[model samples]
Target chain A: MPMNPSLLDNPKSDRIRRVADLANAKARRRSGRVLVEGPQSVREAVAHVPDAVSDLYVLSESEGADTEERSPTLAAIVDRAEQCDSIYIHRASEAVMHRISPNAQGIAAVVDMGALTSEESQVAWSDTPTIAAFWQVRDPGNAGAVIRAADAAGCDAVIFVDDCVDRFNPKVVRSTAGSLFHIPVLTMGADEMLAWCSAHGIAVVAADIYGTPGNAPRTLPDMLADRVAVGQSKAVLFGNEARGLPRQLLERVDRIVTIPIYGKAESLNLATSAAVMLFSLAMSSHMGRM
Target chain B: MPMNPSLLDNPKSDRIRRVADLANAKARRRSGRVLVEGPQSVREAVAHVPDAVSDLYVLSESEGADTEERSPTLAAIVDRAEQCDSIYIHRASEAVMHRISPNAQGIAAVVDMGALTSEESQVAWSDTPTIAAFWQVRDPGNAGAVIRAADAAGCDAVIFVDDCVDRFNPKVVRSTAGSLFHIPVLTMGADEMLAWCSAHGIAVVAADIYGTPGNAPRTLPDMLADRVAVGQSKAVLFGNEARGLPRQLLERVDRIVTIPIYGKAESLNLATSAAVMLFSLAMSSHMGRM
Candidate 1:
């Protein structure tokens, strides 16, 4: 890929405006493009899915100084993007870069939304794989954090069930801290997700502080102690930020497990709960193998 | 105590301005008070340390309506404050409440700063205590989230070692989700923190991905399997958001433990790392006892 000779100095240009508009859901859907802001996210997009990245915009040397004083961190990302034949590298003025995305440290990327979406068939589940699923996770930051947590736990894939934040939202991409490209994230309806898990021979475990009246919640440690179950393939499902899993959903899952709060904290937030639950299961499963 | 008869309709009143200014560190020091925003935090403050809460501000039920229609959640919190003789309940218009604190969900509180500080001597350490300490944690939200995590793990006390965000910051208090009232949070210099933990016969474990050269970090699961050692009293210290613990600090700690990342997510954020580390240790210790 060759770098564009012309410097993009106009922040109001239609090209730049369209790229900035990708931050909006309507713009993303209309253009079939998603903005990946910041060096971390852009770097990951280029490294893991270079074909998906259409353009890379980075802050250029001020006006016309002979010396290139770009920070090494961002320069490395741009260098990596340059290696991809499909990526078009463009230099933009600081103002233009800011207009593109204020959160972008020095670089941003425009990725194809179609290429980013992972079909259910694309997910290659490992033997005894663990999956992380969220139901109606409204907060963009929470959605991103859980994705990163799932990735760190080595989950086979992430499923955003029912009405949830769009995975391509710029804020969600920024919050994932580059983990978005490391794993497959799929969207599915509640019934479809449960049915898919059942068909894949994966047990559905609902993470809720309170289980249905008759089916009392099991403590995380109690579940962990049951090594046979903990080591099996399962999908740990989390609920919305304000309201936890509904009774109907709770009753349908194979098990309801809660992270025991030793102190007086009423409950854990969705992101924290997801990390604890996923990591605990991952560590226990790996340890069981050892 | 009865509710104040006159509804505070003035958002610009000196009283309201002073309370709102408590969001600033200098203002908090000058007024010798801290602002506890949101119904959850205010309720916890009233229930746990009523004597410290001097005033409670709640949204009024409109100008002159015969039927009071305040939210039940807010009304319940107000009722709890009413039982405390020292807490003065005052009704304010929505504008006044917004001016006091936009994040306050229909209620906020003014509490004495002196009462919130936990002297090292005041912390009631358990036989096998686990302390969560952070060094140079700059973000208010991360500071608050970690405190909540520490509380959920039933930590004996929280220590802010060296430079860190003020625990009294309104953003930090809001992020805690009321855990601030449930746990004792004490600030100390790095050296003082280490010395205090040593004096209390607690092991100093630094949570760092990279330990000092030749002193590789132990994985959390590996440490957990050592039931006897994990069951003993310890202080798990975390580092700044951007930087992990300094080599000098990492070298000084009795053990350097890192949470294993099974996938390509790179590293977990400070808040997530703290929750997983604290909760894992807490669970392991409890399971050991069982």
Candidate 2:
């Protein structure tokens, strides 16, 4: 483990302090940056929004183990860096990298704040675009898990609405299992999502556990039928696990979609529900193809 | 809080010590019961599989202060517990209950091992009751979440095969958010699942990250397409985040399903992926109705 001469000589630790506080929402938002620690998370940070990367630091050991060439994942980061010019692989010691992104896999990447995609792009749901949106979700882990689920379910994009956790939060990156990169995740106004849906002629389906009285809900299956028929894309929005979606959103959507609850526990986690609904939409489309 | 005179007068303090150890699997299996805590959880225990609930206890103060009478969510439990049954509901203290179940919600229900449902009532790929089998998933949270998702997806049953976490584990029950009653979960050997699938005409679709070569999928959508074919009901199996499905089982599956990975991470949590695949399969059957 080699230490950078500049830091060793100066005895300055402002950089380390800032990175330590990166876990909090306020610091993350204010810095216009988010920190990625660990080889796995750093690799994903690189893949998802390389352009958002403002600075890159590689622990001397991570650059290449003493005996080998650069690791493939690391090399991929270097390759992706060409787009944004913020990539750096240097001889900072493992200890130093850990100081910046502690518990990181001996590697760290400083990403710019624009990691979230523009919500407008997501609203233009192509006939085949699978999109998922989350609202008022409190848990960063759940939010991250859902993003990974959306990417897995083949949702074209995902959007986050009010009170959801910060997307770039380290916990979120970890939970995504790296699917955060492939899909565009836009954090924007609810009205923006509504407008985008209107423009694209896509339906805004709110997934609610409780349906309006006396009206039989076309199950998520029924909701997907419209998408399958026109070959239009669909977006499903999920709310907080505890309170569920606001009644306003529930009523506003094309229709309420619910996964049946048969057991004593009536609901699933926010992220899990998102996965279920998104998968339903995706499968419905594929079934149409068949 | 109130205490049962027989339990409190306790020459049986040793008994409490032994039961507390049931948090460990070996103790639970040997005892043929799992220790459960929490008011809502206990309620769920009573509501579903009441006979499986071998013992019941409550702090007297918990009776009125617990809001069970007021919380509609607790109604099912009260209704399920026959009035004549000798459930010890004590009103004197909450502290004692905490000793029994940490963070106990005023009540506790001890449950027997999970039961197995027959193939005739399961989800099979052909003209049979279709069910999904989750195999050797390590996380109790993931297991619980999957059960909730399976319930939502309308899978007839959910089975836990091989040596996975216990279904009734407290963490699992908490993760389920109350759907434990809706789905019938069976635990059996890998060979048992294979035999069940063969007999029921169910096509087993195994979700694997690396069933094919070269491309490491970054998102589930990439591989999930195979899980959603029309005209077939399927039982899907998923493994943990670090380890995927067992190779022997993966090889034996009729079709391999994958949720394509688009991000930098290698995979999603088992529950998220299960939800994606299960919902996809359910919607495939239901979309035509829509």
Candidate 3:
């Protein structure tokens, strides 16, 4: 049986304060939980990793709408959440819900970060895996967008190398648009990422405009022309937004590729470049020279 | 000879006020001017459309930095502007430059909008021209990014069909990263666009996920497989961010193509979708097959 639909009317209670505090890194660290806001993210969390979710707070219609029950969309999400016997559902007043998350479109969830972290999971390898890795990506929006692109490109996993934004950051999670739950996102140092890819027989392809002096970069179309290279198990690594990849890291990668600019525009931004390069390679590999 | 390096330090002067007012559509319409901000955009204006630029305002170092002269980057831009002969250069206080545009990374310019509009220019048809068109694209950032993507894809032109965001909006211009100067961007009514494309013997390929009831969309890879279709002169029409194309518009197009999603991502955002679709078709067309 589901819990009673008792409304959480207090905006300043200790529980409310703690839930709201999860937005900060320090608070999240102390509690070992992350906040997922909005209907789309919450629905994704409930659908993909219900075991990770501990509580769900939904807005009450009395405080936010004209009807007595929640909006049809939110009601539908609540109905789905109720199927998970592990999830504790509570209806929150408008003030309480706002305090929890300003972006919550009438629903939010508190999930175990430990459940989402890849540290505790076994590293399984497919026969020919395609991975997406980023080095020193700082912006949350860019980070999230790249992750979504990686997911769309059918990458097996996403690795955040070096000093990158936290995947659990609210802005990052929100920008991902439910992709945070779609794929495995791992964080590691540059050396560790290289070692892991090497161990897994995955070639590291650096996506940079100007490669190191000793190793010039090939255009993406040129790279795609090599059917053997396109079929290899590989990890495509992108660089930071501004500084790009360091020389040391560039020299370490097995191959370097560049996307050609056909017009007067200088270059594509990191997110757009990743999408084009990843999707192009994926399409070429799947279609087999068509 | 270049104009004297006069300092326009007053942030509240009427001249400063008028330059800043170009941010608003009403002000730009009245004065026939548009504001260009940042090093990338200002430099592009001076390089590509020097005749349209009337004045350049650069932040004086004392206002925000240590040196009295302009920074090396800004100094180079100023040097480029000096070659134009008609452009009046001014050194502005940080406050004045900030008032002109908060996004200006130390420089801004006032260019004649009449010079940028495509109305006065002749539209010539290329043998197999590729056009990018959008209907009701409301976001400035999305509009700019799409223009940049279209430029990067070697598109012949961009057409804003029906009601859409102004290309000259400061945010849109800044987001283009100088692609605004790279290609001719025109605006027209839906009927006019259809008529123009028909006259030019260009196919209208709608980039949409769903086709009308009678017309099911074909996958992008399937579309790419047809060499004749890939080599044809066409316009790829993207719809609004949320609503997508209306049924009437979708039915009128020659073909409807969709980008296949390989992962759990619900859908790609406007900019990423545009980049992937535009670049894939471009690469395929130029290279024959994968």
- Each prediction's RMSD over C-alphas, in Å, is 1.4, 5.5, 2.4
Best by TM-score: 1
Q: In terms of TM-score, which candidate is stronger, 2 or 3?
A: 3
- Provide the lowest-lDDT 10-residue window in model 2 chain B: B1-10
Candidates ranked by TM-score: 1, 3, 2
lDDT tens digits, residue span A1-290, model 3:
16445779999999999999988989999899999999878888888889999999988866432346566777777888889999998878889999998998888899999888875153445566789999989999999899899888888899999999889998788888888888889999999999998888899999999999989999898899898899999999999999899999999999999998877789899999999999998888787764
Q: Write the per-residue lDDT of candidate 2 for residues B73-125, one digit (tens) a residue.
A: 33445445544264443322445555566755656666666431234354333
Give a tens-digit lDDT track for model 1, residues A54-150. 9999899765424567888888887788789999999899889999999988899999988988888767778888999999999999999999999
Q: Estimate each model's TM-score.
A: 0.98, 0.77, 0.95
**Candidate 3 lDDT for residue A78:** 80
Candidate 1, DockQ to 2 decimals? 0.64
Model 1: chain B TM-score relative to the native chain B: 0.97
The DockQ-based CAPRI class assigned to model 1 is medium
lDDT of 3 by residue, B143-241 (tens): 999999998988889999899998999999999999898889999889899988998889999999989888899988888888998999999999999
Evaluate candidate 2 and give its CAPRI docking class based on DockQ: acceptable
Look at candidate 1 and tell me the lDDT of residue B53: 95
In model 1, what is the error at residue B258, expressed in angstroms? 0.5
Which regions of candidate 3 are displaced past 4 Å? A1-6, A63-70, A120-126, B1-6, B63-69, B120-125
